[model samples]
Target: MSSEKKNKMPLGGIINKGGTCEDYDTGGWRKFRPILDKEKCIDCLICWAMCPDSAIIVEDGKMVGFNLDHCKGCGICDVECPDKVKAIAMIDEKVAKKG
Candidate 1:
């Protein structure tokens, strides 16, 4: 009945701070991770534009890597890449960790 208890139902948490989630590393929640093939990449930056988490890393107007700390493995980047290039591939997280 109290305000403190009102937000404590199921899957609940308090928003102590107001800003982006830069402090929270949500990459551990990913079931799959994207791998980029530089050879096939054309640096079109389509992946960077389509990523929901803004996980795509670019430098000097080129795709360089991924910001895994914030990436939730949504696979949007892979889907957004050019079909002819197919530069991004989604690999299972478990398999990727082994290597």
Candidate 2:
């Protein structure tokens, strides 16, 4: 290969200064669950039961809140929900950081 051509090729395949890998922050490993629209909820306690962390809570005969601290953001609750429109969603921590 010519000198110019060799220069154009990466040296030792090492990443250059300008190159970047996807940045994944390990700082916030905590996961969160977003509760669904109240109008869409049918009082089915699927989310309350499916949460492995027991993050969901029922209060005063209604599904009230989710304990984000214990939640791992697993999609089980969102998937198992019987509502036509899924009531719960797992939000990505990284995306949350952008806002």
- Tell me how many clashing residue pairs each candidate has: 0, 0
Off by over 4 Å in 2: 1-28, 97-99
TM-score of 2: 0.58
Evaluated with TM-score, which candidate comes out highest?
1
Model 1 misplacement above 4 A: 1-18
The true-versus-predicted C-alpha distance at residue 1 of model 1, in Å, is 21
Q: Provide TM-scores for the models.
A: 0.80, 0.58
Give the CA lDDT, 0 to 100, for residue 83 in model 2: 52
Given candidate 2, what's the lDDT at residue 63?
A: 81
lDDT by residue for model 1 (4-98), tens? 76645434565666765788899999999999999999999999988888888999999998998988999998898989999999999999999
Alpha-carbon local distance difference test for all models: 0.89, 0.67
Q: Model 1 clash pairs?
A: none
Candidate 2, 1-99: lDDT as tens digits: 476566566688977766252242322446644656677777688888887767677887688766655666776878888858676766776675575
